[model samples]
Target: MTEHATAVAALTPAIADGPQTIKVIISGGFAAVYRDMLPEFERSTGISVETGSGASEGAGPKTIRHQLANGTKADVVILSREGLHKLNEDGRIRAGSEAGLATAPLAAAVRTGSRKPDIGNDVALRKALIDAGQVVAPSSTSGQYVRDKVFPRLNLPDTVRLTLEARGTEAAEALRAGKANLSIGPTSELVQESGIEVVGLLPPDLQLVQTFTAAIVSDAQAPEAAKRLIDFLSLDSDILLAAIKRAGMERPRG
Candidate 1:
């Protein structure tokens, strides 16, 4: 049998055994592809999905780590490797149940119809940041990289503004609302939003290709169904992975 079929067959029993719904809390890093492929997973396994959004890496209440600690119900949690590592360290993820989902590089975007800046090189990217009065970013892994690492390298003046939002899509919204001149986050999240124009990946030296991962939460209510969900996402199915690539993310690299 084909790999995909074999994977699906393993989960068929769960559908008959009892409840078939699995709760998932995911960050935007993997949300694009997940949303794209979810219907097929449900069709194959007869499992229903209930999903919500969270941030992958941040101290805020929106982070998966924080929510899980606060008694959020999630059979599966999708987030950055950094956040997963933290969950793992804290024993929040079920041991040996993690699967890598996809990777996406940080990118810049401006409100559609705005002047696009040249950020192809380090110097040009620096100037672009300065030229734009304020740059908006999310509180995810990519934003932390910019706030913690990239800005220090540029050493721009205090006059440059930085507006941070709780999520990547919100950062895009900030740009669309004229709250900032540019937004930065995973390419997969912002590139698909209307009224947003992606400038491109950050200059090579400053680029971060964040790995998004999926794992069963330790307190998952539907462990078997959650495993099946992870299988469908990571089985390397061309139809889904191709859609992921077309949506501005790369297949996850081990």
Candidate 2:
């Protein structure tokens, strides 16, 4: 048998009998790709998957941390590396089971049919932000990165108006509602919204790439199945790499 097929065959023994169901709690960054690839996983392994999604940040009860704290049942959890590490420290997930999945770069967008601004360099980006009437950003990783890191580096805070939304999608939502002229968040979130036209990734010097990780929950009822699902999502295969790309994320690099 081919090496890939052989490896997949070896995982069959880990599949629970009689059509198992695996529960997953995931953050927004990786949600689109996971949802897209789940059907294939079910077809190949005869396992049904259930998923719950929430913002990666915010103090709302809908965040993944809040859900877990409320005693949500999750066989697997996918979130930012920092978040996963915190969860691991809290004894929520199995130690050493966390695996890096993908990285998503921050991107900017404008409402559909709006003139795309020039943000190709530090100077141009600063000018664009300064010139914008209003800017929208998520209250999570990328937003914090921009507010703390990029703004200080640029030294032009008061130049642009800023609004922080609860979720990444809310950034685009603000733009769609005409409440803001610019929206910034992970590329995965920006690209999925129909009312916003993503300009491009932020310039390399000012960009923040959020790394997402997956782990089996500590008290999972289906740890083996969860591990298999994590393996299937890994970039070890070209098929998954394509899916990641299509979902607007890149494979994690060393």
Quote the positional error of residue 7 for candidate 2 in Å: 4.7
Clashing pairs in 1: none
Task: List per-prediction Cα lDDT, in the order shown.
Answer: 0.85, 0.81
Residue 248: error of model 1 in Å?
A: 1.2
lDDT (tens digit, per residue) of candidate 2 on 19-58:
6889998887887788777877877777789998866656
Cα error of candidate 1 at position 201, Å: 0.8
Pairs with backbone N, CA or C atoms under 3 Å apart (clashes), candidate 2: none
Highest TM-score model number = 1
Q: Return the TM-score for candidate 1, rounded to 2 decimals.
A: 0.94
Q: For model 1, what is the C-alpha lDDT against the true structure?
A: 0.85
State TM-scores per candidate.
0.94, 0.91
